[model samples]
Target: MNARALGLLLGYGADRLLGDPQRGHPVAGFGTWALACERQLYAPSRTRGTCFVVVTTAPWVGLAVLATHLPASRTLVTAAFTWAALGGRSLEREALPVHELLFEGELEGARQRIRSLVGRDTSALEAPDLARAVVESLAENQSDAVAATLVWGALAGSPGIVLHRCVNTLDAMVGHRSERYADFGWAAARLDDVLNWLPARVSLLATAAVVGATDGTSAARRVLTGASRDGARHPSPNAGPVEAAAAYALGVQLGGLTTYGDRVEDRGQLGDGRPVSVRDIRRAATLTRQVGLVVLGAAVTATAMGGRLRRR
Candidate 1:
């Protein structure tokens, strides 16, 4: 209704229509710079990493502020920024190929296809594990790619969204468990976790609400149970809720016993029964879209309600 909500809608519509930049998204540019910075500034301690996080991400906030000065270009900038921040179509585009490969019973093809989506060793993954990983990624990325961005876009407009994207890109570039980056990536990883914290919960609730509407399941109990039983096993505070809710939504078990690197560990189960499948992967993709829509809808309502109250 208002310009802000309309701008946000147009931005999300852009994602649905345009997907990602085929060649040069701004986030890609940031990623390249971040990698260069890591190579030049990396140290075996957290202090440098902490400073790197701030130094690298702070400029985007400034850029965002500068963009605000061009009132004539405000809507265009916001729409473009939010479009870049949201990745609904690309997320499904990546996930579906894995499903198609798995559905064709081309296990090797599926493995190769999945590499584009996840960083995990696919050599050992069976079809089910591959599907499970896709579903998990879809859920977590729903938080990171859609909900987190939309939340920030609504709360602080373009600058906040840009800043959040910068932090996320930094984490992707350097955050990991490897010795070279374990210490140096601490700040990037932690900041990403902090930013995604509330958004992750919102994503989980959005996912579980969809499931409840479709299956008559109790969104609260299932989400809570899945979170409690399986959440503790996950390494991320934010990822746990998103992945757990997705598992419950699909009525499929995820996590369980799995191999990671050189270690084999039981991550326990998240949902009720059965391993994930191609069908579940499709469902997860649909659920990802639903979650994004829910976030957008909520934002519109909140903005409209706030505007009304302000007038009163």
Candidate 2:
């Protein structure tokens, strides 16, 4: 494999083995910068949001561009980006803790742990309901946080990964529909959706493939079809497919009544199996890891093919 692929592979290993470093997380730093920008630039308009995105993303993009040019810096830069941007380890850390807390019958602990994983209100959730929420978040984010990074890292090395993370960060920070940010966050939300579009579909197939590998199925299409039905109910164009696949794969149902800060959203339903359980939390993390492996494998294959094409 080429340096880029090698770097990504190493980076994946680092994230899997080490998660993220305890201090100086690049995303956290970017978060601070982004919040500051938003404070100074916030308005109920798209123009200001657009400007916020540009201002926040420009520095990272420029540094990535510079990093790509130095042959000596390529491996280190790619590895660094992979470590920082891809969130498989972080996702696992956040996810499995809920299962642990739940398994111990610590509903209060589980609720708090669940909060670390999703934006929804966890205060009143029963054990099963909380498990469903964790599974849903893990599955959806498996695409957004893990698979998408690998995809973008393979496509454009550090620059692609960096920019994608920036977009995703913006969405998490400002893309929600609060009264203060409804219109202002519109652009950020849409950009995140568009960037995530292909990756989310890829995530569905990846999840289905994992299911097929273990279930003795030959055709992915059949599994995908069932998963598709599950995904169709979600409001997000991208999250629906992956979360639906997770629900199907995990033998559980997700989506029902979800509470945020104060509002309750009835997001219909997905899947048709057992109710959520603590085990599904571990299952969801395992599934995301498997998908991450698949994404990395694809990246390696693509890098190898690109090398051959260049020779041709």
Candidate 3:
């Protein structure tokens, strides 16, 4: 296998086995640095936000470029970055506990646990709403944290993955519709939208492909139908389709009124079937794993083909 492809697989394997590092995670460290920079760089101006992005992300991305150029260090660096960038296992770990809490009828515990997974308010959520939150987070994050990371890593090696993660992190930090961030987060939000566009599609299709492979064509059609009907109605260009796909794949409804602090959004109806239940969360987790496997196989196959073509 090519070094890039090998590194990608190694990193994915490590993530599967180890989850994220317990301490000193590079992404966590980056978050700290970015927060410090934001204090000094904060402004309502888009220009200032743009500078913040450059200052925070450029150094790391530049280092990736340099390290990737070294034959001896390329694969190791790519593997390390890929492991840092992907969060599928952590997504599962965090999500399933909410399921456990809900299963045990610990509504308050579920609500508290769910706060770690979603930005939406959880204190008043009932079981159905709590289930929806976890499922929705799983669906959206499957693309944002896993598929996108793999796509960029395959396409541009270490620098591509790092850039995508940085932009995404910045978006998560500042991309808000609130008065405080509407202007300052514009660039990060826009850049995140652009970078995630293709990855979201890939995730949507991968979800359908897995469903079709296991459950046959009729089941898969639901995945496509859900996206076609409701994907555009949601606010995020990337997340809407992915969540819609998951909603159908698991045969549950998602996306309705969501509360983030004082803000309320009508996320639109995403799928057909009964309202989401705690059981659906487990199903969503399984579907996420299947989708990740499919993406991994596809990336490795594509990389191998490209390497062969170059040699020939």
Candidate 4:
């Protein structure tokens, strides 16, 4: 394997084993700095939003570019960047506790724990709604945190990986329909959509492959068919496909009345299967892990093949 592939695989292993560092994570630091920048840069204008994105994200990308250029430390630098960017294990860690809380019949505890995973109002959510929220967040975040990070890393090396993660962070921070962000967050939201476009489809494909391997072709076909039919209907262009695919792959319906703060959204159903229950939470987590492994394998194979072809 070349430096890129080897670094990515090692970083992936590190993530699987150690997960993200508990304190002073690079991503967290970036978010803090970005928030400060946003305080100064926030304006109800798309142009200002564009500038905020460039100002906050460019430095990290440039630093990544510089870091990867050190021949002596190239692999180590790349691995570090990959490890910092990917959050597959952290995503699962945040999600499974909600499952555990539900399994123990602690509805209030589950609701409180789920707040870490979703932005929705969990206080009033019952068991089924809580399960749906966990499943949806898992499916969508699998694409955002795992698929997109790997795809950008494979395509553009360290800088690409950093850039994707930075843009995604900005989107999550301010990308919303609220009055405060509707205009100011346009650039981050659109760029995230563009950056995530391929990754989301890759996520769907990964879901299909994993489901097919585990549950046979019919289930895989359901994932694809459901996504094709209902994916575009959701507000987010990228999230819809992956979430829909995951819903069908797990044989559970998702997307319904979701409350975010005072905003109420009736996201139409995705799959035709039964309403998601507490049990499907673990199933979804397993499916996400399998999908991530599939993505990792594909990324490694592609990077390795490309490396060989370039040599030829």
Q: Estimate each model's TM-score.
A: 0.93, 0.96, 0.98, 0.98
C-alpha lDDT score of every prediction, in listed order? 0.82, 0.84, 0.91, 0.91
lDDT of 1 by residue, 32-121 (tens): 878777777878899999988887887878988898778666677878889988888998999998899888899999989888777677
**How far does residue 15 in candidate 2 sit from its true spot (Å)?**
0.6
Task: Give candidate 1 misplaced runs (Cα > 4 Å).
Answer: 217-220, 257-260, 263-266, 307-312
Clash count for each candidate, listed in order shown: 0, 0, 0, 0
Local accuracy of candidate 4 as per-residue lDDT tens digits, 1-312: 888988888888899999999998999999999999999998999999999999999999999988887766677877888898889999999999999989999999999988889999988999999999999999999999999988888999999999999999999998898899999999999999999999999999999999899789987888898897888778888888898998889878988778999999877788888999999988999999999999999998999899999999
Model 3: per-residue Cα lDDT at residue 14: 91
Residue 97 shift from truth in candidate 4, angstroms: 1.0
After superposing candidate 3 on the true structure, give the runs of residues whose Cα lies further than 4 Å from its correct spot.
71-73
How many Å off is the CA of 276 in candidate 3?
Answer: 0.4
lDDT of 1: 0.82
Which candidate model has the greater TM-score, 2 or 3?
3
Model 1 Cα shift for residue 198 (angstroms):
0.9
